[model samples]
Target: MVIRSRRLSKDNTYYALKQKIIDSELEPNQAVNEENLAALLGVSRTPLREAIQRLENEDFLVRQPNGRLRVASVTIKEVEEVFLIRSMLEGYIARSAAKHATDKDILHLTTMMERIKHSFQLGDKQDFVSYGFEFHDYLSEISELRTFEKVLNQLRDHSLRYCRYVSMHGDWNTQADEEHNYILQMIADKNEDGAEKAMRDHILSSLSTALARIKGMEENEIDHIGP
Candidate 1:
């Protein structure tokens, strides 16, 4: 099983690097030194290159003018484009979830929502984002649409850094909490149309906030995204 072990190692390395990018530890447009990253991750060049290649295919890393790799930067146009598609996908998922979700699912989401609300009040944006994702993940899971779930997960991961960035700049937490509560209510009431509409509205609202943040940022100022 040596080969299998190596495959697992490569996958682990890939996800670790991807998470670093997503969390902005490796900031947008920041240079990537292969040797340094290999040393830091404690992996050899071969596996590191393999992981890097995968990230390149995913657009997480891009070749720069100086022929070095850097984390991909965000754009207002891309944010709007991604969120528009997300609105449609998540709206469909909410519709299906409202028709299929059980009491257990509802209760779990409600509890998670309460935790999210509490975290928001404490100004813990990180935990708030985490719980917010968990809430959406649960709804996606209950929808039982594997293809839709997979695509939505990828889209969410791509947009999460931007989402967190804009969220930290304003009172998005309070507004998002209210919107989430309304969505949850729609799901609980089994109002498929309402659930769909609520989910789309919520995503569109976040997109509005993200677009504002993107507009305010200077191209060189993206690295300073966090509070």
Candidate 2:
């Protein structure tokens, strides 16, 4: 369980824990005991503590009043805050990408958008969701803004669990695909203003739809982990 970290990337332990948290391999609301996790990851407590602190700063995990770390969870408020921030950042990224993206980048995004649609046709929710994640990164890369990409990457892993839950139970992939088409066209046309508005609308609409679905599922209890 050696955690071999390369010098090229950011903190290795933080990312490892982040991925595990995002993948749901580490359960939500589950307590992380430092000594155990340190042993498990084959790292000393110092680096593990450093990693946990980073996650704590990011709001991915929180220290309870009782003084232990757990995957952070809150009511619908978290959904609102995260989605609002997402709308802003996504709108900016889309607009910037329209201004900066190359033809090749647009083509790549188009290909990914098509892949998302095809994935839905195949009823592969996992794939549709995963490709959606990639599409976002592609857009961020094209925006030529490392800050936005960094912010997005931080939000995305946590968002994946929520998106997966929504896609699995929400039954609105087709609508999502339609929204993707709108965004793609806006970017392709290099309409920065239009792309920004469209992206903001899409983010709000998606959030609304997901919340509605979650509300409908109130009869049956489900854990909604939001970014």
Maximum-lDDT candidate? 1
Cα-based lDDT at residue 20, candidate 1 = 85
Candidate 2: which stretches are off by over 4 Å? 1-10, 35-44, 145-154, 168-171, 216-219, 222-227
With candidate 2 superimposed using the best TM-score fit, by how many Å does residue 197's alpha carbon deviate from the native?
2.3
What are the C-alpha RMSDs, in order, of all predicted structures? Answer: 3.3, 4.7
Lowest lDDT 10-mer window, candidate 2?
1-10
User: What would the per-residue lDDT of candidate 1 be over residues 1-227, giving only the tens digit for each residue?
Assistant: 99999999999899999888888778778888899899878888888999999999988899777789988887787789889998999999999999999999999999999999999899888778889888988999999989999998778878887776666565564788899999999999999999999999999998887887777776436657745
TM per candidate:
0.92, 0.79
* Local error of candidate 1 at residue 48 (angstroms): 0.7
State in Å the error of residue 19, model 2.
1.1
How far in Å is the alpha carbon of 63 misplaced in model 1?
Answer: 1.5
Q: Best candidate per TM-score, number?
A: 1
